[model samples]
Target: MDPKIKSLPTMAFPQISGIAALGFAFLIVLGNVFLVPAGLPHAGAETGEVIAFFTTSKDIVGIASMLTPLAWVLATLFGAGAVSVLWQSDRDRGEAWSLVGFGGLILQNGAFAAVIAIRLALASTTAHDSTATTELWALHDALFMLNGTFLTLALIGLSISGLRAGLIRQWHGRLGLLAAALLFSSATLAPLIMDQAGPLGLLGLIGWLMWVVWVGTYGITLIRGGAVPIESQSHATSSKP
Candidate 1:
């Protein structure tokens, strides 16, 4: 372990992070459950449909938007906790994968913030301003699709690092990697996928579902004290030597 790196409380960090991760997942699922069936507009939705959704479902959108900030906060906490858990192993191996994962979490927070802001802006716009609303929705779709890149990065970095450090089981690591691949594929095809609301959107949706599961399980593992820190192991090894 690097002396420069401040040590985190093993017990507290995992517990807090586990709670945050579960909270984050719950909020996301909650928002989607309400919003998706409420006729939330998809990418390339008709301008009229988009406007109608914002106008009719203003309360739903507002509620979901309100939850977004909290979700972002929880995600950040989870990422920070994950990094702390992986810090010793990463340092010993001369790797910064956890930092990469952390970066992705931060970037995605900003990206999703923009996405929600766009939704709010659209809600406020007059139906008469169809042109502006359409343009705004387009931007929202682009941002939403592109946001997968950050998610992919987060999954890849953390999954690989955690697996290498034996912080997560092989099944967990494989699931994360698979989710990352799906998300990345969706992001890579964003231009095409965003043009029309087709089956391509399912790719992202599936990946997102997997991501939620992955995070939730990770949180559960932490809560159960499954993620043993590499620092403790290192200390044991070093003392013996």
Candidate 2:
């Protein structure tokens, strides 16, 4: 290690990270659950329907958007914590998967910020501005669907790193990987799916649910300090010479 390089205080924030992760998951779920049933427009909703929803449900939409900023903040903190915890193992293995995961987290935060901004813009527009609302909503749907790509990257990077580092359980890693696959598939089909709302949308929805569960599980595990594999323990011992 370079003499000037400062090591991360990895041991100092597992509990805090765990709580942040849980909070991120909770906020996402709360926003979706609260909005979806309150007549949030579907992906293929007609322009008139979209306009009406935004105009009438402005309060609900505002409430949901309000959760997004805090959720993104919590997600960034959790991502940093995860990267810190995996840094040593990644260095030993000559890998940067945790960093990749962190990048994805940051990118998703930006992407979702744009999504929410568009939503708020729509909410503020009058129904008379149908053309503008239609265009904006279309942009929103496209961005929302494509945002799955960032989620996919985050899941894949973290799943691989956590599993290799023995920091997360096999089932947890598998869940993350599975969610990544689903989310990636959804993003790949974004053009087609965004054109029509149906069972196809369920792909991303299922992936999102899995992602939430995976995040929550990871948080709980981190709070418990995780379990080191025997091989990792041996490697650490051997490196101490």
Candidate 3:
């Protein structure tokens, strides 16, 4: 490393944020496997199936729902760190992608929280009113639509930014592009067919899985990149005055 680069301030914020985000993702997967009962139906499932799932998994689901907000908040922090790192690479041009990526993440997390909130509220019903349950489930799916859209934009924006900045590898960028394409296609085409379990839907699911991997790698890249030139540049500017 150049002496100037080596002399730049080092920060662990991005690394810590990355680890936290990964931990939160792990927690979600674990919650689904152990806390939530298996064979649960989806938001677009039949009324009886939906009720059955809630009946079986309400308490555990509620617990997970309660914890999700915190998880997303940590994700948001990591996302911001991602933006910071990208900004350092190309200040003027990177700004647009960084802002879009940050906004997308915030919206995605907020929508996720809203979906959980709606579900949690429905779960509180002692008696499973079929009408109320069905409506809430519909709302949950709708929220997921919005969440999915934001997620697609987030990955696309971040991937492109990271690609241009050389912060992430080319293969990683391509993976993100593929994931984004799958999600966008699903978001637009699947609803037309009204097939939640159709090809597009499966694509979306695969995309989501890819998203987890993409984010994990993205966070790690950000962590490994470290905060140097940004801090150092600002310091140099301040000292000049």
Candidate 4:
């Protein structure tokens, strides 16, 4: 490592925040996989079915639904942490991209929180109004469109900033780009092709997992006292493919 790199200021707060974000994201995945039903029906599910599901899975659903919003909130903080690190590094170079990424991430979290809140409301309610449930579920699905699009925006901006600012490795930047592409593809093509079934949402999920790993690895590097300095930015940018 360059001497200048070793002299740079440590970013311990953002590093810790990033690690926390990773932990929260893992909780979300675990909740989804083990707590929520795999074969749950979408919008237009009968009132009886909805009630039955809520009645049967209420405990786990309540816990998982609560975890969902908490995880998303952590995601928003993760975005902020990225912004903090990059912005502190070079105000002029990383500010715009970091802000853009942060904004997109906030929007994505809001969208996800909305969906989770709706699910929680549905699960908690004792009223068996099929039409109301259907309408809410439809709204939930519609809001889900924001998830992939905003996530793509966040990834693109962060990856570009990371590449240009030398905050992360070239391979990591490329991984972010790939994840963003997958999210964008899923957001655009899934709705058009999958419709109500929305099987293509899996693409977004996979991309999200890829993104988690990329960000988590970067966070771990930072926590391990990796070098990131202004003088080394150019050399870091040109290091590898």
Candidate 5:
């Protein structure tokens, strides 16, 4: 005779959280693959000259190609999809914490967008004027600071979800938290390590891209069906001591 199964406690939050994580991952990869090569400043002999070269060129298609994925990430996270995911979860408490993480992610990415725009603007000012400018450059700096702050907070909340709860079922949360640390440091602290990396840090972008791939792959997995083996209610409950 076939065995009967107990209806395990449903973890609906995890199902939707998995989906959102995928969206974040997609943009990260899209940004790296499409945007970075398409829009990054070209290398000339001197830093200032290269910045000047890119300023005049200002390839709108290239810029749009890069910024498009970023815009999607921002819009999706703030949109109804993310909120629906939060709502569908089993417990209100988990949803609350996830909201904090979601808010942090949106704010951090938005601030980072400001940083990128500011950098492009600064390039324009630096190239056109013979004299160095501070005002536009300072906007970029402040935005970077804000980005770092929000990114750190988001990672912290995700970390708590993994550690405090000891929720191994949320592997994506753990992975995301780790990826955030790598990318955040790469973007913010690369200059301290080397003069060469300077403004365009390679490590941070690489880390972000990897994060995108991981999250996207996981998300696609869910859309094809559900989070079967991992996020399944029976699967999660069976592993508990």
Candidate 6:
């Protein structure tokens, strides 16, 4: 191995992955704060128009245009680390389960991509005035459950690995579990924002965004510091999930 490269087994890939994950987290937050609001309509007798306005905002446009692909790339990075850290080992009973959990991450994020595609489809079909657009959005709402499912599986897999392998500190493991719960709850409340303004709706977004941010940076400091548990782990953690 090249001396410099040999010093870091993964060739400092984790740092690059961290940067990408942070960028993706920022975009998701940006979409939630500015673009998501625009797509929804404000209160009053014109509530439907208000909901439609935010639902169809340029932000959602930007999401389908840019963020979906970005999410796929970022997810791949996380998946790398996860594959290495959680699923590659026979040390824990959860190894096979973590594989399944992170596998859900792939599927869940795919669902989000589906949502973005559905949004873009709705926008494109508007010019023709088709009933299919409405049907699609309803389907999109249902599909969003996948993202929450992804989070739940991600946290569960890691949390189980943490307990069994002693891979992560207790706090981070607990936080991972909590974040999963928040993410799942968000799916229920996301569509409610259309019915009326409510704290649960806003809190759900905030919680989920925070969840994304937290997960992105989790284990990063240890990974860079060359912590023993991380380095000596039996399998590779792809950082993808």
Q: Show the colliding residue pairs in model 1.
A: none
- Tens-place lDDT per residue, model 6, 136-186, is 655765565436767677777756665455555777777777777776776
Worst 10 residues of 3 by lDDT: 190-199
Model 6 clashing-pair count? 28
Q: What is the lDDT of residue 139 in candidate 2?
A: 92
For 1-241, candidate 5 gives per-residue lDDT tens digits of 3334455555454455555666565555555564346444422124454455456556642454465555545434432333443333323233355456556667766776676665556545533553343444444444554365565555555444433333323566666677677667765663452334345555454555555554464455444443223344344355556
Task: Determine which window of 10 residues in candidate 1 has minimal summed lDDT.
Answer: 232-241
Return whichever of 1 and 5 wins on lDDT: 1
- Report the C-alpha displacement of residue 212, candidate 5, in angstroms: 1.3
Error of 4 at 231 (Å): 2.1
Where does the lowest 10-residue lDDT sum fall in candidate 5? 86-95
Q: Runs in model 6 with CA error above 4 Å?
A: 1-10, 41-60, 88-94, 126-130, 185-203, 222-241
lDDT, candidate 3, equals 0.73
Question: What is candidate 2's lDDT per residue for 77-184, written digit by digit as tens?
Answer: 889889878877877777899999989899999999999999888887664487787788889988888889999988998899999889998899999999999998
A best-first ranking of the candidates according to their TM-score comes to 2, 1, 3, 4, 6, 5
- lDDT (0-100) at residue 184 of candidate 5? 72
Per-model TM-score on C-alpha atoms: 0.90, 0.90, 0.82, 0.78, 0.57, 0.70
Q: What are the per-residue Cα lDDT tens digits for candidate 1 across 92-211?
A: 776788899989989999999999999988777655488888889899999998999999988998888888778888999999999998898899999998787789898898999999
Q: How well does candidate 2 match the true structure in TM-score terms?
A: 0.90
**Selected candidate, larger lDDT, 2 vs 5:** 2
The global Cα lDDT (0 to 1) of model 5 is 0.49
